[model samples]
Target: MAWAWLVSRAAALGSGASGLAGRVWKIGADDPRRAVHGLKVGLALALVSVFYYTRPLYDGVGGAAMWAVMTVVVVFEYTVGGCVYKGFNRATATVSAGAVALGVHWIASKSGDRFEPVIRSGSLFLLAAAATFSRFIPTVKARFDYGVTIFILTYSLVAVSGYRVDALLAMAQQRISTVAIGISICLAVCVLICPVWAGQELHRLTARNMDKLAGAVEACVEGYFAEEE
Candidate 1:
């Protein structure tokens, strides 16, 4: 059953990616909006690459710079609003989760390596169970779903990664910083560079549809009264 579910999820993701790739090349200058969005995507990725290559902050943020770069790739959207919403979600989720992970690592570190495996493994199970359960509640799930998801992932990484790395909290901190940086870059680029807003597009579409509907109704009413004239 689990294998079947995994396969189904993978297939869905692959299908969606293929569909987007197929449509991307079809975009042309006739629809400049698509071109603009494509440009934003490219620019965001370029910024990520620049940060990853340049160890501008060689202190604590260098090791996990790739995580920041990855965040930029995943967080950016065609619309400014979408980018903002997802950027906030990703950063909030990652930082909150990383804090918890760091706390667990600290406790394990003081206790010594004899109990490290047991402590880390136990924490992973407990955290995952609670988080997975919390995700079912409607209101809770809607807002902090990403947070819960990230918490689990971050905890697991810390648990396993601490075994090899002496500075578990340091790594987690670096990861959190990288995520913030990546999200900031994405938000800046999306807002400053020929910004497109989802809310504005939605309003425009709604207004246009209402106008079209009104025109159709007026035409129909006039035709119905023609016999009286």
Candidate 2:
């Protein structure tokens, strides 16, 4: 009975894998552009991974190289506009947050051990609350929502961790630099390699739709005149 149960589970898993493969193939077949996009992403990742694989590059950023990898993963988008938009927002947010955190860390450091924790905690709460609230504002939400979110995350991480970390400035700088590197790589890959422009795609789709609508109207008008005649 156990053997039979194991075999049944294996068969189910195999069927699931087959179905997944079929769906993947269908998606690629439906739009070859999607496959190209996937290749672009893989190429970008490989380019960024050099910071990890090369000794000189690894030494420069150290463990912070991982941030570059994460940046590539998060910032790379299907469209060039989207990728640039996200990359800019992330880099700006990280720098802004890191600077503010450094300032707060400095202030807290001078306040004596007893008050240091209090100051950091209070600042974290206030900044986080403010950032979260800003997300509700229409304009900010539309353009800068992702930036605000990154601000909150980066600020919280640096401010809270600064308490125990001696080289807070160095760490923040390394991370910011690595993030910039990643953004640069993503932009380069997205723009230079079989680039996908969102604006062009939208324009083409709109033109096609307009043509269809015009054809339909022309047919309707001809049918009406024929009926009258």
Candidate 3:
């Protein structure tokens, strides 16, 4: 149950990350190119979390192989999308770090029988930081923070699995079929319903923000002209 809560919270964070990335594109944020960067960063972070928890879904494969496959997917999808959205040459530091973390996951998984707490914790921190920072950070340098968040998250999962493999396995089984179906339905409904619901809320908030911004700008303009006169 606790793991389920953590997973749900992480998914929410990922969804918000996606929405924020979209907002960055819509608004032409600083270096409009960063919007594409943000999207890739968000996708990479989300994929890492997905890959870490879904290990049992695949059979008999070593952790390294599984990690490699997921890393490739994240890279290919992000690169393809980034090329289309921003341009072929428009890669960000975040994407590079994402690749590095994926490689690390593979290595850590293959290294030993017992999970490495340090590496796992580091990965979780990187992932969480990446997802949070990609959309919110205006500074380009902060993009690598996702690496730390994901490192920590992956490590935590390993710790749980190491201690209670049966429990973790059971959770995985329940989540795979049931959670997937439930979430698929919920997402479909959200797509159908949220636009109308969220649209109204967003419109109201946007209007309010515009009003405040307009008043502030007007006051600034008037003050400047008054000084000139």
Top candidate by lDDT = 2
Alpha-carbon RMSD of each model: 9.0, 4.0, 16.6
| lDDT by residue (tens digit), candidate 3, 134-185 | 6456653343343434334443454435433534334333323332332233
lDDT of each: 0.81, 0.95, 0.46
Q: Is candidate 2 or candidate 3 better by lDDT?
A: 2
Clashing pairs in 1: none
46, model 2: CA deviation in Å?
1.0
lDDT of 1 at 153: 80
Q: Residues 161-213, candidate 1, lDDT per residue (tens digit)?
A: 87788876678778888888888888888899888878798998999999999
Poorest stretch of ten by lDDT in candidate 3: 81-90
Rank order (by lDDT, best first): 2, 1, 3
lDDT-best of 1 and 3: 1
Q: How many backbone clashes does candidate 3 have?
A: 25
TM-score attained by model 1: 0.78
- After superposition of all CA atoms, the RMSD between model 2 and the true structure is 4.0
TM-score of each: 0.78, 0.85, 0.27
